[model samples]
Target: MTSALSLDGVFLVPPEHHVPDTDRAAATQLLGCDDRTLDTLVRRGLTVRDDRFDGRDLFNLALHSGTGRTVPEQAFAFSLRWMRGTAESLLAPRTLSFTLTAACRCADVVLALPRPDRYGGAVIPAPEADVVAGTTVSATIRTEGRAVPLRSPVLRGLVEEFAALGVRWVKLPDALREDESLVTTHRVATCESASRWLARRCREAGYAARTRIGWVVGMLDLVHAWVEVTDDDGETKVVDLIFAGFAAGVPGANPLLTDPAVALRTNRLVPTGFEVGARVARHDCDAPVTVRIKPVKE
Candidate 1:
C-alpha cells in the first residue's frame, strides 16, 4: 500500500506512509475526487513512467477537473485559499542562523559583521574579533525564527496592497508590552516588523502571507526581513515593504514586487548577497554552514 509520490519536484518520502486524516480529506477535495475514488486516482496518477512533466500534468488535470480552469489559475486560487486558512500557523517556531566571511574594509585588525536577529534586523557593531584589511574572517550566530510560505497570487496581492500604502522605519521598542501587536501600530516599522505586520494583515484579509527572515547582501549589506508570496505560476517573490518607496520606477508604481538587489543598488546600499532561504535550525541550533569572503587580489 506504500507508494512514492512527487509534488512540485519534491518527493513525499515513504509515500505509503499515513497522511493525517485532515490532510487526506483536504487533498481528496483539492484533487476533486470523493474519498472512495481518491485511492484509484492517486495510484493512477503516480504510475506514470519517464515523462518528466507527468506529475505536474496529472496535478493540473486533477485541479482542472475540480475548478474548471487552467491548472495555473486553479493553483493560484487554491494556494490563496490555503494561505488564508493556514497563514498564522506558518509562523510556527523555527531556528535560523547566518555565517558571514568578509574582509575587513579598514586596517583596524578587526571585522565588523551585522549579526542576525530574531526579528530580522541588526545593529552595526563597532568591530568584533581580530582581522586586518584584505584578510578574511568568519563569524556565525544562531537564533529562533519563524518562516511563512509566501507562494500564492492572493498573498502577493495582499503584500502589494500593503506596500502601496507606504512604509516607514520604526525603531524597535525598548520593550514590547504584553497584548500589544505589531500589526495596526503603523507608526514606523523595521523590515521584520513590517513584514510580520503585513503577514497579519494578509491573514485578516484572507490570504496566507509569511514574514521571511534571511540575509540580503550586495548594495545593502545587512541581515534583513521581508515578505514572501508564491504565485500560481509556482514563482515566489520577496516583498520588502519597508523599502517600498524606493520602488518608484514609474510614478506611483507598487514597489513591493521590485527586486531587492535592484532596490538596494539604487539606494547605494551595495548588496553583497542576493539570495534568501538560509538554513533554519531549531532552538540553540549551531550547525556551521560555510560562507567565505575573499579580498580582491591585485
Candidate 2:
C-alpha cells in the first residue's frame, strides 16, 4: 500500500476533478491506499468530512507516517511540495513572533539583535537584550517579510545560474581529507561547507560574496549558514545552495532558486553576531553558551 504513494509525498489531483471533498473510493485511489489503509489513516488523525477527504490532509498523513525512503529522499520530496505550494502549511509565515534567550555562566555576553532594515523584514519596537553572568537575557522580536513571485523576470538569469552551481556542488563526492581552508577543498555536504564553497565560486566569477552564520526560520527554526552575494548594481542577495539544493531533485534544475524574496519565503535569514565580554578567571568563560528560540503563537 505504501508503494502506491510517491516517495516525496506529493499526489496531484487533476484540476478538472479537483474538489475539497472526495468520495471514499476516490480518496483511497488518490492516496494509493486500500480501503483498510484509508480507515487506519483516518484513525491516525487524517480528517474526513462527511465520508469525504481532503487531498492535502492525505498527503500530510503519508508524509508524516514515514515514506520508508532515505532522509535525503524525504527532504527532496518535502522541498518539492513546499516549492509547488502543495504544502501551504509548510510555507514561510508572513509575520512571525519569536523569543530569543541566551545564558552564560562566567562572563558577560554581547549579542546582536535582528534589524528590520538588514533582514528586509519589519520589526516594530526593535529587539534588545543584555547578558550578564549567572543571568539569562531574553527578548521578543516580531518580523514580517513580503512574498516575491517566483517567476520574476529580473532574477531569472541569476536564479538559473545559482541553481546550476548548486546542482553541481551537491553531486561532488565527499572529501577524504579534512582541510579547514575553503580554497583547498571542494567537498561540501553541510550548510557551512556548501555556503563557503558557493561564496568562493561566486567571488571567482567576479561577484562579491561572503559566507554568513545565522538562523534560518522555516518549518524548523534553527541556526544555519548561507552565502550573500552583491551584484554590480549594489543590490545584495542571498544565494543559499543548501536550501535551494533541497528542491534540486533534477540535475541543472531547481525552481526555488530565485530572488532573496523567494528564498526568504521558506528560509528567512536572521544574522547573529556574538561578542564575549571580560572574563573573571582563566576558565571562567570556558563554559559553552546556549541559545533557545521559541515561536510565539498569535
Candidate 3:
C-alpha cells in the first residue's frame, strides 16, 4: 500500500469529524449512544433506563419502543445454605426469603421452598461438606444423621418456595418420604449463547474450534455442556455443571425447588473454570449476536 503523500497528484482523503468539548456530548458519549440505533428507540417510546443492563443499546431499544422496564427479581434461595453447621446446631435461628411458587391442587398444603443458593455447587463444595452429609440431599435433610424430628422449618421453607414458582412440590424429609416415589431426576440446560462463548474461549486457549451450531440448535437434543480438563499425562476429566438455561423440566418437581440449581449455576458464572461463549440466553436479548470464532487462515 502506498501513502497519499507519495501520490503523483494531490489525493483526497475522507473528512474525519472529532468529538466536541460540549458537556452534553461528553455525557452521552460515555453511554455509547449512537444517533442511528438509540435515537430510533427513544423516538418510538418502549422502555425506560433504570439501574440495569447499564446504559447499553438494549436500554435504548426499550426507550424507543415504550416498553416496560423489565428487571430480574431476586428469585429464590437454597435450603442447603442453611445447612452450614452441624444438623443439630442448624435447627433454630434460621431465616429464608422467597415468593410462593406452585399451587398444590391435590392437598390443602401451602409450601414455601428455600431461596436459591448462589454459591452452592458452582464453587467447590466445602471440603468438609461430604465428610458430614455424605454429599446427598437425603443426608443433609436429617439432623445428626437421624430423621427423628420428621420435619423442620427447612422442609417447610422448601415447600413454600416451590409453591411460589407454580410447581407442585413437597418437602420430603429424608426419613419420611417414600424412596421409590422420589426418583432421582436429571436436568440440563441448553445455552446456545454460552456455547458460542465457550468456543471463543477454546480458541483463546489455542484450540482451533467452532461451536457445533447444529448441536446448539438442538440444545434440547445435545442436552448438556460439560467442562473437560486434561492433566499433564493427558488423562481428561469432565465435570458437569449448572449453566444458563438449565432445568426446564423434571419429574414431580416445581419451579421453586428447581431454581436453586439455577442459583448455584448463576453464582458459578464467573472464574469457576470458564472459557468464552460459556452462557446461554434465558430470554432472547433481541436477535442472537455472534463474534468472530476464529480468523480464517490464508
* Tens digits of lDDT, candidate 2, 116-210: 33555545455443222234434555444333443333343545554554332222112411112422332224456666655666676777777
Evaluate model 1: give its TM-score: 0.33
Residue 242 alpha-carbon offset, candidate 3, angstroms = 11
lDDT measured at residue 51 in model 1 versus the true structure, 0 to 100:
19
lDDT of 1 by residue, 34-83 (tens): 65655555565443333122333344334324244434335435422322
Query: Candidate 1 or 3, higher lDDT?
Result: 1
Candidate 2 clashes between residue pairs 3 or more apart in a chain or in different chains: none
Report the C-alpha lDDT of model 3 over 90-112, residue by residue, as the tens digit. 22221221111222232322221
RMSD of each: 19.5, 14.2, 23.7
Ranking by TM-score: 2, 1, 3
Query: What's the CA error at residue 166 for candidate 2, in Å?
Result: 7.2
1 or 2, greater by TM-score: 2
